[model samples]
Target: MVPQLRKLTLMRKIKVDIFRKICTNWPNLTCLHVDFRQEMNYSLMKHIFEKCPRIEKLKLWTTMLIDQRCMELLSSLEHLSTLEVLLDKPHLTPVRLRLLTDACPRLKEIHIDWNYFAPQDFEYFLKANKHTLTSATLLWTVGEAQKTSVVPLLKQCSTSLRKLRLVYFDTPRAMETVAFEALGELHSLHELSMQYLSTYEPKLISRAFRPGCLTQLRRLLMQYTTDLLDETVIAISQGCPNLRELRICASYKITDVALSEIHCLRHLEILELSRCSGLSGTAMAYISQLPTLHTLILQFTEDLAKLQPSLRLIVELKELRCLDILKSGNIKAVPFGEFPNRLLKLRELRVTYESENDFTELQRKMPNLKISNTAWLTEDDFPKDDDADYGYRDG
Candidate 1:
């Protein structure tokens, strides 16, 4: 009866008969996200393709091995534009990718765990969808032998690709200067996220971007790289003048010098620095210079003394709306009473405090502000900006 239903998400598994019946009733559905545990067979996939003619986005989290028949059936969804397949078995290959991209030519966005496919497979997929693909999430674990020239493949779709996410489990050696040179060629890229694990050389990833290369970039996130330098941040600030959101996590090498350089980004709105121990609170004066800043997150600093002075600088962010200072148990409770009415726009504040009165007093002072004493806050805990595209968030 719900024929007008346009979107649906099912986190839990459903019976095959029930799924088919639901699909039959919601023929106009354009988006579907379902956990197809054991019910993902050719017949079920066929029913979906036949029933949901308007389906544009499809996410299948399954335990079954995806076969050629399933791929072929998915190809029949001519309206499909975004595809996400999280499977227990590694069944996505270059040949399968060709089937989907060739048949469903409208498909432009893909979200997949790159661990399921080889480096060559990824290359082939990018080359195949180079013209139409706009967004891609490449999440993989790097093996020593798997180091390949991925940036060049990404550049093939530079004119069309807008958002890209690269997450590596075991980061390899610092990329040669040539690799980042190729990455800078993505002229149309709007958002980029690079995350690494067990990274030692602090300057490895920073060398990836040269000033004035990624001019179109608006949002950039680097996590656990420990590989950013003051020069790199300065280059980013000078090059990407329009950048609005910037987040760097676990970067121990970035000092107050780099933080001072960020004042060049006049359009910057959100800045998050997590576990960047090299920063002294003195650089906070530079942050207060940003006229457009609304959200600030300085998390996981071990030294409270270094942060106490920085807290005073935050009052200068007249446009500030949200602030999070949650650290891993090391941060002692800091009273919010110090933040006066100077932060007129401030509405939400998150911190780790032991006393209940600290929360009560802050609420009493700023009746409109919402304060949380959460011990931990993840990316999901913070609400995303309303204007965010491609699931990019300030958090």
Candidate 2:
């Protein structure tokens, strides 16, 4: 008979004994995820690097302050190729951050807590090691000061970067000109995600039109942003001809006009629109015209019932394979009989409802549907959020 193997992960609190056991037994571990709130003891960190010599990827989430001791231990991991650090307190000194890049010479990707360092410290750290960075994610919590610091870094580091995700901490107008100007120069970038500050305005969407800004982009995701009105959407749809996947959530300004402009996206295959209350039946009618769309996610809309009758008109979507509708209020009133009897290529369908009558009706219409009747799907279902100790995940 074969013996069973054991597994361990750092969770709430990493005691010294647990750390010692992990170090002594998991020497060849390739991936390590640690939460500093539970495992803040410096000795455990020292043991991790000294004993787990084969560890190549590390993700650390720290709820407490980071000091020189943690930095020194992190610097000694000779085999680390990817590192993700989320800091609760803004205290990663410029000296320590620079030491991290220098220590891990082969580092290819880095994700840092955007709120942890001052603008000057961030710029200095980026300037020191722009050559080795392949991808970077920044979460900004401060306003214009952070954006000003980040723009110059993006301009300088754009040459080697292939993916960049930025969460703006300030209003749109504060740093639009410089940030977009820098983005126009990133000729090599291919994937981009942006989360605009709450006070973002729609007029600033024109800044993204700067020539070459999105020429190489293949995937784009925008959240809580503005300026997605008719004109801006038309310009983007025409500009990003190579875009294959598009996700726009909580962008309330988009309307039916934006859907009309999407016809220019000839290569698009996936579209996700969640909490976009402005989209109506007219928008769905226009979306039905897209021949290449294979996956569609419509979630948390206030008036999904109104669009239900239009479903039959779009049933000709030959490539459509997956449909997900969850948390959309009053969706029970939508008539399932309006849909075509045979969705020949449909492989997956997810629907969430509040009433049993709605579930029974939907099951009668689509007997093979996978129905989940939860009031809400919390962060616990996803492995990433359940495991993260310090990094914030948007709902």
lDDT of 1 at 157: 43
Write down the TM-score for model 1: 0.85
Cα-based lDDT at residue 16, candidate 2: 70
Backbone clash pairs for candidate 1 read 202-227
Worst 10 residues of 1 by lDDT: 385-394
Off by over 4 Å in 2: 1-8, 63-65, 89-95, 117-131, 140-147, 171-174, 199-201, 209-211, 226-228, 308-311, 330-335, 338-342, 354-369, 374-395
What is candidate 1's local distance difference test score?
A: 0.70
Candidate 1 local lDDT, 89-200, one digit each (tens):
4433423565676678798998764334556556666777778889876553322265665676677644689987755433345554445677788888888876543344
Error of 1 at 162 (Å): 0.9
| Total backbone collisions, model 2 | 2
RMSD of 1: 4.9
- What are the TM-scores, per candidate, against the unseen true structure? 0.85, 0.82
TM-score of 2: 0.82
